[model samples]
Target: MYQPEEIRILIVDDEPSILKFLSLGLRNEGYQVMTAEDGLSGVNAAQEFEPHIVILDVMMPGMDGYEVCKLLKDIGNVAIIMLTAKDEVEDRVKGLNLGADDYMSKPFSFQELLARIQARIRNQFPHMMGDVQVGPFRIDDRRKEIRYEQRVLSLSATEYELLKYMVVNHGLVLSKATILDKVWGYDFGGQENIVEVYVRSIREKLEDREHQLIRTIRGAGYRVDLP
Candidate 1:
């Protein structure tokens, strides 16, 4: 079992209250917490503190969370959970598309936030952690790398998670709701179209006319047909 004390979290929000609240709450949960006021400072903290996970606010002054998320993704393998005040699906999708591991809207309970953090950690570092080999695809969770037929595939964090989930459950049809729940966490209240977006993105990278690794089951969902 992974201990909370072993995980370090960075909270990046413009709102001082949110930073304080989340910092205190996460610390109380035995996690090492760091807080930053703006996206630039958050980036600095991420580089300096080297947290395992980052809780980022979508709306921020100067450098926005999207840019921050992009920078962080490029910088390290830190898991990001975007926070938004708006309940818009576009916002959630945008964050996820930007490599955010998960998202949470404002006025969210601390318990829910904690759960999201833990879930992200678990997904990133599972207990029975090992690489998944389905056909020509190799999903490496620890290194966050994917290889197809000896060629490396460039995938975002969210894309890697979705692909790993499908590869782990190869030959099984997975509904959009189930994909959302597993990959994005149960706190996701956005439309199922996000799954379609990620699926298309993954297919573009991993599939071709001759090798169709993923199949879209009409009226059912999607499945990764292993060779």
Candidate 2:
């Protein structure tokens, strides 16, 4: 996975002070963060934020951390570290039982919490945002490098991003809009043809003229599968 610098985190607690402290400390440690001061609000923020990690407090008004954690698990498998004064064995057990990846007792040092969250994220999505291999294609997510069959194909930065995006989502019929959204970010003006242009370039550079992995879906955008 990418380092803490690129990781997005959510810190949820009723205590504004703790939320502020963790947010500052996590940001200083090179992680992005969003905070919520209550349990129900935390859930809603999580839905919108799509954070990589969530720091939750056990006691909160309305929903509480356990319920929030359970609800998050149902939505998706996000790394969760519970932060609370309830340090009893049963409390820890309950937190883990509720699908928390880890827990931190209150009065926690930021160093420990940050370390635990990083480790948990690594375990969850080790290859997606990290060095990865899919068939003959080798990907270095950090440096944004890719190679096929030991040959490095010359690619422009956008072309590289587009190709890497396709390989990462191999076998998915990704629409041009979806590709633009993920690779070009939110500011991409309407330019659907840009995707078609780059996809064709990637095909020319990465594959032999005889065999190609990128397939046009007629009405859809593209799909990446082994040739």
Candidate 3:
């Protein structure tokens, strides 16, 4: 998974205030952020920065967001979120039709924008987002690591795989057979009891002594439930 610092975001808006506001807020969130005053500069920045996400404004003087979005899509696989002063359905549809991944109206809540950014990354560019946040866990597949509440957990290679599998499939009840097949491979010659042992070890590391996070589903196997 990619860390926030590893993820690049480009903010393109003619408005100075919006640019400053977004740049500061996104940088505070730890992303590598760049700003562009208009659509043309935004495209230039996208080419140089190769940002994973772009927050683009629709009404620009020279090129406008639709054209820029189209060009960006042609250039690379970027997740583009369009910002428009008008909240009309037609504007939203136009942006989407031009390959914008998401749309936001002006005066939008910063928190809501942040949520949309995370959602786009989760849905569209999962592999590029670095450390992805699934519930309370931050999974970094690249480093083969997991962090709970910002603290990195010490885990072995197999332990990491088991925990990552459980966390990725957080709500489902994973049976021993399924876990073994997915994590240990289908041809592994281990008994089902092995899943239980690893689960206990992972729970200890997670400090889930009360069995709150990872729970035993009786006749079923184990499930990871985030509080």
Candidate 4:
């Protein structure tokens, strides 16, 4: 089991209260916690602190979360959880599209936030560490890479996790709630529609190659059919 003290978390928010509150809670949980007031500082802290996870606020004064997410992604291998005050789908989608591992709307419970952080960390270290071949899809868990029909897929961490889960459970219809619990972690506290957004994104990439592995069972959820 991984210890909380082994994990370092960086919290980036413009609000002083949020920073103090989250920092205190995370520290109490035994995680090494760091904070930054804005996106630029967040980027700097990411480089300096080398945290395993980052809690980033979306609506900052300058250099919003989307841009910050992109920059951090370029820095590589760190998990990001984007925070947004609005419940707009576009904002969430934008964050995910920019490679954020997850999103939490403002006024979120610290318990749920902690759960998300733990879930993301759990995903980083899977019990299985090799490649999985299911139908036309090949998943390299160690490298965090996926290939379909001899072509590589450019997937965000969340998208890769969702696809890998579906592939592992191929031929079974997985409900949105189950996917959320398994892929996004339990009690994610976000709308189930976020699953649809990621599914569509994966479909657009996979189906564009004229290969359709994921099947939608209307009113049920989704399944990846074996080729």
TM, every model: 0.61, 0.57, 0.59, 0.61
Residue 75 local lDDT, model 2: 90
Tell me the whole-model lDDT of each prediction, alpha carbons only.
Answer: 0.84, 0.81, 0.88, 0.85
- Model 4: per-residue Cα lDDT over 179-201, one tens digit each: 99878987589999999999989
Q: Please, what are the lDDT tens digits per residue for candidate 3 over residues 49-117?
A: 999899999999999999999999999889899999998999998997788877888889999898778
- Judge candidate 4 at residue 87 and give its lDDT: 97
* Pairs with steric clashes in candidate 4: none
Residue 109's C-alpha lDDT in candidate 4?
A: 94
lDDT by residue (tens digit), candidate 1, 1-227: 46788888999999999988889888888889999999999999999999999999999989999999999999978889999999999888888777898888888988877767755665665533456555787666668888999989889999988988787667768889879987899899999999988888888887654446888888999888877
Candidate 1 TM-score versus the reference = 0.61
Best by lDDT: 3
- In candidate 1 the C-alpha lDDT for residue 133 amounts to 58
Candidate 2, residues 26-128, lDDT tens digits: the string is 8898888999999899999999998889999999988999999999999986889898897799999898778887778879787777667755664455554
Question: CA lDDT of 108 in candidate 4?
Answer: 97
Models ranked on TM-score? 4, 1, 3, 2
Segments in model 3 whose C-alpha atoms lie over 4 Å from true places: 129-227
Clashing pairs in model 1, backbone N/Cα/C closer than 3 A = none
The worst-scoring run of ten residues by lDDT in candidate 1 lies at 125-134
Better of 3 and 4 by TM-score: 4
